[model samples]
Target: MGAEGWRWQDSWIFVSLVIAGGAGRHRRSAATRRPEGIRLTDVLATADHLNRSIPERDDVLGAVRRLAGAGLVTVTDGWFRVTTAGEQLWRSRPSSGMGTTVDTVQKLLNRRCQPGDTDWTLDEDEYGIAVQEYIVRLLPRPRRSPETAQERAEPS
Candidate 1:
């Protein structure tokens, strides 16, 4: 299965994985957090890190865009920063609930879309994205199952 669907999350160290090991390293608290904006190499690095058997760069990009669009991230020239919004979103989530599919979509999105040359204000189009962003935030798949094994186990 691609990174797009539900998969086993190493529940033992879920927090570290969810934030891509960047959350705690960058912050003392949510208020004090600053998400480094997008760096091409960084996104590529993350893409490589998440590059599983399935080519789900699209999914990963979706995740980044959601985070960035939601005010969770601030993408500047060559650097990506996660803002307070991001820390809050990541931290507020339950450590052990099934992650959301919306998150999977966002991840893919992030993997694909690079940050614009300058900082962007989230607009109406982005608002639509934010809706997905919020849903994805509410639930992050890959971090947890988006669906059940039974769903996949059964043949169509």
Candidate 2:
């Protein structure tokens, strides 16, 4: 299918498949290796880890079905693997940021409280603090350039 048809969930699932060994081995190792596809259970685990929330089984299955229909992935004996087309599509996907840090942090917080009591809910101030802490923990600090490092070493 065209890249235009891909959704964020679909892309995430595709990536999971690829990381699970869907793309097979490198050219140099192809002769000595065989590609192993992932099972639905494994995919579910991966989704849980990535999304930080348990996803509906049907939702994941639907995404896999769409990918199969597009010839981007293949299924055999309950295992799923990415096709060459899928790899190509993955490589060509836009590198732009998909969402802001606050949005992601909020989603994570929401998931954490989904099954808990009302007392687990965060107040506005608490939520803001949580978001800030998560963002700081999640995003990497910038590195100094070589020129800047040299200048700092030399002092003002």
Candidate 3:
């Protein structure tokens, strides 16, 4: 994959798929870990081998959005599955030299948008805004309201 079209997170997801043997979803519990499936976190962990840092939640969401936008995959019930086109793109990738790039992303899409196994997919823009909101939620809490602060300062 080239190093321009995709955000880094997208490459991580694709490479994770390649590494995980086409497992679409990550197993949540170690006890549930299967030979076929891998954890999402482990995807990031796998990226580490490529010298790519694991993405934060927002980046992961963005990657998923990009994939969905291209109809390469679908996100449903909190899982992602590659479509037939996604599979082709995955297969087309060189055995070595993976990078994040628009070209790479396009290669993943391969100008094909196929129906996926998932029941749902998100609109890229809406999903992006939603993920931004989620990131805001993750930020540290703001200072207490003036009234609450005053009351607390006054007495128990």
Q: Which ten residues in a row have the lowest lDDT in candidate 1?
A: 7-16
Q: Per-prediction TM-score, please?
A: 0.37, 0.49, 0.46
Deviation (Å) of 5 in candidate 1 = 16
True lDDT of residue 34, candidate 1 = 38
| Candidate 2, run of 10 with poorest lDDT | 113-122
Off by over 4 Å in 2: 1-6, 22-34, 94-156
| lDDT (tens digit, per residue) of candidate 3 on 1-156 | 122356546666665544544432333332434433433444455545555444555655566666666666554554445555665666665444444433454455434332123223344565455445545645899789899889988965
What does candidate 1's lDDT look like per residue over 1-156, in tens digits? 223332222111122223443664434554443344333333333333444222133333444454454455555653556565455555554344333523543443344433322233334453345344434544655643556666787899
Count backbone overlaps in model 3. 7
Clashing pairs in 3: 3-101, 4-101, 4-102, 5-101, 5-102, 6-101, 6-102
lDDT of each: 0.41, 0.51, 0.51
Q: What tens digits encode model 2's per-residue C-alpha lDDT throughout 1-156? A: 233344556546655665455342235332332466665555655555566754454445555666676667777765677777666655444443433322332333233222111111213453345335544555788999999899989956
